[model samples]
Target: MRDAEYCFWHSPAHKEEAAEARRLGGQRRRRERVVNAVYELEGMTNVGSVQRLIEIAVQDTLGLENSVARNRVLGTLAQAALRVFEATEFESRLTALESVHERRGKGKR
Candidate 1:
């Protein structure tokens, strides 16, 4: 029997696979849309906001197939999370320093 060539989407043998792919694609699109809307409305204005964004990216990236691109993205997100940690530390140190300076000024007066 001569079998006709058909693409995955049009192949009778691949109907179930194609349907699964379509369902996953729709789910991914909906998730991306919701993430985008939340990001736009919240606008990463603080450490918590920034960390949440990085966390979401990491979670989504983890679902991706293992590849060089996925690894690179995970590396970048890790760096970003580290930076947020550094910023939080710096902010705490700066606040302590300001408090010390204020006490010193009051004592000198």
Candidate 2:
């Protein structure tokens, strides 16, 4: 006899497995959104507005009030910030070195 609660494809024994599959599917979708946001932001000349929007969207979409999801969002933001900071710092140092060399060349002439 077949169980009515589970239909033809799902048996009582597979109930938990079905639930797990649904949960994983949701997680995978959320991750794809995050990855796409990162790629989209990477191509932008300025990411401040877009990044904030994406963060809010991800939080809402992923239920990031939950610590695990929140941590992932925060970690991604931190990495982006670090990369921008390092690049800016390098540019500033390079500019200062060029200025000093230019002043020395002028003095020699």
TM-scores of the candidates are 0.63, 0.43
What residue pairs are clashing in model 2? none
| Candidate 2, superposed: residue stretches over 4 Å from native | 1-43, 46-63
lDDT values for all models? 0.89, 0.70
Give one digit per residue, the lDDT tens place, for model 1 in 1-109.
1465888888898899999999999999888779769765355688887888898889899999999999999999999899999999999999999999999999999
Candidate 1's C-alpha runs over 4 A off are 1-41
lDDT of 2 by residue, 20-109 (tens): 888999999888789768754443455454556555555664664568767777777667666766777798899999999999999999
Query: Candidate 1, residue 43: CA error in Å?
Result: 1.9
Going through the candidates in the order shown, the clash numbers are 0, 0
